[model samples]
Target: MAERELDPTVGALRGEDVEDRDWERVQPRRISDADWKRFEGYAAEILRAMGMPLDTPGTAKTPGRFLSALFDSTEGYEGDAKLVTAFPTECRGGPDCEISQVVEGPIPFYSLCEHHAFPFFGHAFIGYVAHEHIIGISKLTRLVRMFARRFTVQERMGSEITNALSRILQAHGVALYLEAVHLCTQMRGVRESEQTTRTTFWRGNYEATPALREEFLAIAGAHTNGHRS
Candidate 1:
């Protein structure tokens, strides 16, 4: 990954004070008055045109809440370096320390498919040959979860995951492998109902040699032979 100044926003997300709910709870996000008004204006008008009363007990605050929740779902749009930078930076530049491949979960993630606005849910495996430095294990999972909430497309998500890992670690190489079952496909009337989508990406040394790549994949627990087909 090309080096650049670390982003403060990323750090903000990783800050100690950020609520645990911010990353885990998929709740309705509070939206601005202006945005809510605009959304409700259209929603109310549409309901009125269809001769439905927007005043029902179950529906009165629905529009505002719905819009707020929708925005909240994509909250990863607010990406920052808070979590990544929170890791000690000393390990990276250490002159005499050795590099090692660190495999990170099986980090479970869920995100809306950009095209259908339906969910693509799955686990991610990340591996990086840290150049005398390594981040906390939880931070790796948090980072994957961050990108999962941010992007609409798996390809983009995969790239973002790869870039972020490589960027923050400034490693010898990084590798990410993702497998997801899209609700839109499996539950919806799609041809490949039984199939799941698989995406993988790597950067630096991991991208170069098949042997090195497979080594990392094995460490990252990429299921191959003798696994469910």
Candidate 2:
């Protein structure tokens, strides 16, 4: 598979050369039905070893259900072909061109942490300044869910969304903010239930202009605080 290029500005924010990693290797591969059956059996055995009452009426199907849910939750690995499609911008160019930021926010998403396999869920806010093309509004939600369904860290997921949008739209700028409550953090280790993780990524013009970044953040932050309250 061909490697996708990460946006340089966003990559820099990550503090590493993102091109070093082969993203395709981390995506989900097709699993045969036989393989699934074998996996189910292994899961059952593991649950039994863990002292789970597999023979009980309620627990007998728990292994199968668990595997099914996991498969569904990580469906982002399948990839979305429609993500790259764009529409002609409404704004006409020249001196009369009125360029502005398009923002979509509070897009709910859920994902499993790669390390703990525990759920992290919350809202995403995306903003981009269009160039010659603009994407459909609903595509933003799909984009968020696509990345969110993968088994990954919060920071990486935000970067993926930011970079993908920047590449697809070739936008003048791209901005993304993610706020989530991670079960891995709340349900284990120190077990701080009140904790939540927030991540932001800015690229192109958004990075160059502090006003634009702050505007996006203000809109996203207002909606987030209001939604939670």
Candidate 3:
């Protein structure tokens, strides 16, 4: 049987923030049964073509599951960053309050390694200095999910998360660190006994001042040597 770690599935996408745009408008209107059958058959063929053993019990459902997982992983295209921006957290001074604040996150995330489409899973630690606004803590994780659920390489994911904070929070500074393991590499290919991948993006004040940057890195357990804990 195919084994999965069974991490928490994001519960039904609730909250008024979720948009109801009809995705069907952009997708194919129809696929005939014959066509569907051919397409479905292509699933197994794809793995077989990739040199994956289909006869293995662990892979029996992989063809069907892969198709489902592929679509689900790339669903970020449907999200609007503006949705969260619309209701920017109100400050006592009404989003004009500036404060140097750190939002540390041990937030869990999941994504597909672009090179393999196998799972990459782990946590992100984010810290930012808010300017005129304090975002809901939940939104920080949402931001991480927003950026992760898109087509991106690991380096891009790290930078995009920090970039989003700078743009939305109008932050004075932001620091984001991503530590995730790509199962495609670890379990399928040349397995390394240590070290997965670590990517970080420090922007604005985080980049301009060494002390400020070090403070954030210290919190993330990152070393000046470009290594992470």
State which candidate has the highest TM-score: 2
List residue ranges in candidate 1 displaced over 4 A: 1-31, 41-62, 86-99, 221-229
Local accuracy of candidate 3 as per-residue lDDT tens digits, 76-128: 55564333441334444432343355757677788877787777877888877
Task: Report the Cα lDDT for candidate 3.
Answer: 0.64
Residue pairs with clashing backbones, model 3: 95-132, 97-132
List model 2 lDDT by residue over 195-229, tens digit each: 77899999888888888898899999999989999
Candidate 1 local lDDT, 1-229, one digit each (tens): 1123343223224354254324333444466778768888887777668787778997787767766666766778665345654344455444333335677677788899888878888778787776634677788877877778854788988877776666566567888888888888878768555676778898877667687677766755545322334
Per-candidate TM-score against the hidden true structure: 0.69, 0.83, 0.68
Clashes of 2: 0
Evaluate residue 108 in candidate 3 and report its C-alpha lDDT on the 0 to 100 scale: 78
Model 2 residue 190 lDDT?
Answer: 72
lDDT of 2: 0.79
Q: Which predicted model would earn the best lDDT?
A: 2
Clash number for every model?
9, 0, 2
Q: How many clashing pairs in candidate 3? A: 2
